[model samples]
Target: MEGTSFLKEPVGGKSVVGKIVDNITNAIINGELKPGDKIPTEGELSEAMGVGRNSVREAIKILEAYGVVHIKRAEGTFVSQEYDSKMLYPILYGIILQKDSTNQIVDLRKVIDVGILHLAVAKLAAQEMPAHRLSRIEEALERLKVEILSPEPQVKNVHDADVAFHMAIVDLTGNTMLQGICNYVDKITRRSRMMAMDQIISEGAVEKFLEMHQKLADLLKTCDSSQISQIVEEHYQYWANVKE
Candidate 1:
């Protein structure tokens, strides 16, 4: 940890604790602190960064919440071993707080989903995909079918199934980063999906929604890139229509 004194004094506007968090996060991102490395003690950080111990402690807590670091009771705080889905919370929270219109959010989701489908279809078309690999998508679609067609389909159940179906398609792309980004976007749009589902149920069009999802599943199996974009557009069109 030699020569690691890169944190600067707090600047204007931002709180000292927030600045401390930023500095520590920057250190991690800059490769100064690798995973599993213990961070400087609060006393050391406070003195070096010209911040109070309380600020250092608060910064550590923020980092922990973001999955950027982990605290070992009685031991020092260390960088997280694996930055997993927990890291998506901050980004998801940001999206949730944004003032984007419902239609705009739906449009963004549509674009991401369509792009993911294109990549997945391309991959399937270029290679002989294993049946096992595609099984999850089929399973998800089956769950969705069951949920939507149930005698009394609950909105929450339908929404979860719907997310699983689309997430299955994202998984087919075999791109971790894409999957993560899609997961965040998909999570934030759950409310919109619920709203759309409610509208469909009220309109007595749940059967139509079921048919569209079933068709999308069928189209995915074909790996026909030429037709996927159009079908994907139609699938999302339902949401746009509902929004309008």
Candidate 2:
């Protein structure tokens, strides 16, 4: 905090409290403040930020609410230990508020799926995982197979199974942040995916899609990154080509 200096007065129509929040956030981002490191006291922040104490307090409150910081009763405020799922709410909310298109959602899902596949493959290859670690993925794939083979398969059932398959891969990545983001995207795009499933089922492509998912599941067990990449590409590309 030694190099950190007083913040400039609020400008450009930004609220005073908003300016304080930005200053504290910038300090954290710039490594002037680090996780678990207590921030300046309200009086010190108010003086350094050139804002009223109430303004500084309000800024801290906002940060705490966003899970950006935490307040200790007897101790001072500190940056959050690590950003958790709560931090994703604001960005997810913004995306929903902007009314992103279905195509955009599909694109986002494709990106997340690709990243998850890559990381999962790498982790599986590099680490010594338990034999049963990927049981969830196998179980999900089995459920998908059953759903697709059912005489009267519901589109909703297939979609849920499909999501479960990909989510299992995301969970394999061992990165909590990426898992949280993918979870958020998956939840929001559930309806859009159901629509896509309807189209795929209508086109008589449900079996083909299920085959691709099975291939992905098989390749994951091999821990062959190249094969996994090929299967993942084929899986996502098939959906990309599906007419919306």
Candidate 3:
């Protein structure tokens, strides 16, 4: 594939406007451009794209209208949430912007994730998922338990474990949209999480967080989607308590 930031053309029919919109959008969609990362200044993008600053500005305006980015007064520009299929754009914007805690996000995650996993499970067979998935989920859960219990947990591990847990679910769903949204949220909010959580991870707390993981595995093992939602919510509530 072409670099994530570059658009693919039919080898000869590429247009300049098409390429600029295509490349910038590709960068954002492919994680080359990220949520908190500022877009290149108008002057910079003009130079880089070999287009006039007016063209760059127009493209940015179009992207803003698409709900793909937001421009702050002095903080420059940032990416928005990956487009949502379930929630309206305004609602998703509120949830992302007004959230004061990763715990709050965890709360939203639990509620929204419940619906997603329900749809995902519908895509799978009743017999069971695969053994590899059970192992991946369990391993991801184990890593999370370690992060929660370790006296001096690194933030990187927690981020990886967290991503692993959710990505594992994306795997279960086998849906690109599910994975895309997960990646989208991760990109958009990851910086705030990194900053806010740096001091909180090792703030002297320990507990059996893995029980929920065990419960989820149990539900999956028996092909029971009924309890999976509760298990997911129960697991995330621990993090939600960080604000309490």
Candidate 4:
């Protein structure tokens, strides 16, 4: 924290809290600060930046909420060292706020889902995967099938099962970055996704919906990467039709 004279730079343009957030984030981006580095105390930042303590406190709160920084009860704040899903909230909100983002969200999801499916298929074809991992993928598919075929399937149950089924395939890739990004897109579109599931079920298309997931699960064993896009397009058809 001693060499952070950059924090003392005069603020201009944005609101006081926004400037503080940007300065600290810029410091991190430029390698002036690093993960796990302790941020200067609120009093120290206020004095350096000529801002009120309240502004610094608000900035710190925002940073902590976004998973950019971690605050200990008495040990002060430090840059986050590990992945936190909260870090994706800003992008999620930005995507949500955009006009006509449903198709965009559907497109975004289709791209990742297709990529993940291709990667998983390639990985499965290339490796002698552990029995447990293979079982997990099958188990997820079975759970979805069960929920969809239930005597009186609950919309929430079917929706969660559907998400879990794709996530299981995503997990097969063993790529943390892919998993993170996939989960972020999944979260941003959850409300629309749930509504889509309700529509599918209400239309008595439960078998058709379950069949699509079954085909996706089957593709893991049979379909080559070259054949992923079409299946993914069919998979996301309902999602794409959902209104924003």
Ranking of all candidate structures by their TM-score, best first:
4, 2, 1, 3
Please say which candidate is ahead in lDDT: 1 or 4.
4
Please, what are the lDDT tens digits per residue for candidate 3 over residues 75-183?
7767776653432444456667774745566666677678766765665555355546657777777888888567767777777676777778777866666676666
Q: Given candidate 4, what's the lDDT at residue 135?
A: 75
Candidate 1, residue 103: lDDT? 69
Candidate 4 similarity to native, TM-score = 0.87
Q: For candidate 4, lDDT tens digit of each residue in 24-138? A: 9899988988999998899999998999999999999999999999998999999999888788788778877888988887888888888888878877887844436767778
Which parts of model 3 are misplaced by more than 4 Å?
Answer: 1-61, 64-94, 99-104, 127-131, 145-151, 188-205
Query: lDDT of all predictions, in order shown?
Result: 0.78, 0.77, 0.64, 0.84
Say what the RMSD of model 4 is: 2.5
Better of 2 and 3 by TM-score: 2
**TM-score of each model, paired residue for residue:** 0.82, 0.83, 0.52, 0.87
Error of 3 at 35 (Å): 26
In model 4, the runs with Cα more than 4 Å from the true position are 1-5, 128-132
* Tens-place lDDT digits, model 2, residues 1-244: 4666535434235888877888888878888888998888998877766668888889889899889999899898989988678788877777776654555656666767777777777777877455477899889989988987788889899888888888888888778898889888878877767777777777788778878887777767887667655666677654555444
Best by TM-score: 4
| lDDT score, candidate 1, position 150 | 87
Tens digits of lDDT, candidate 1, 91-210: 667666777556666767777877887887778777745546678888988898888778898989988988888888888888887788778777667777788887887788877787
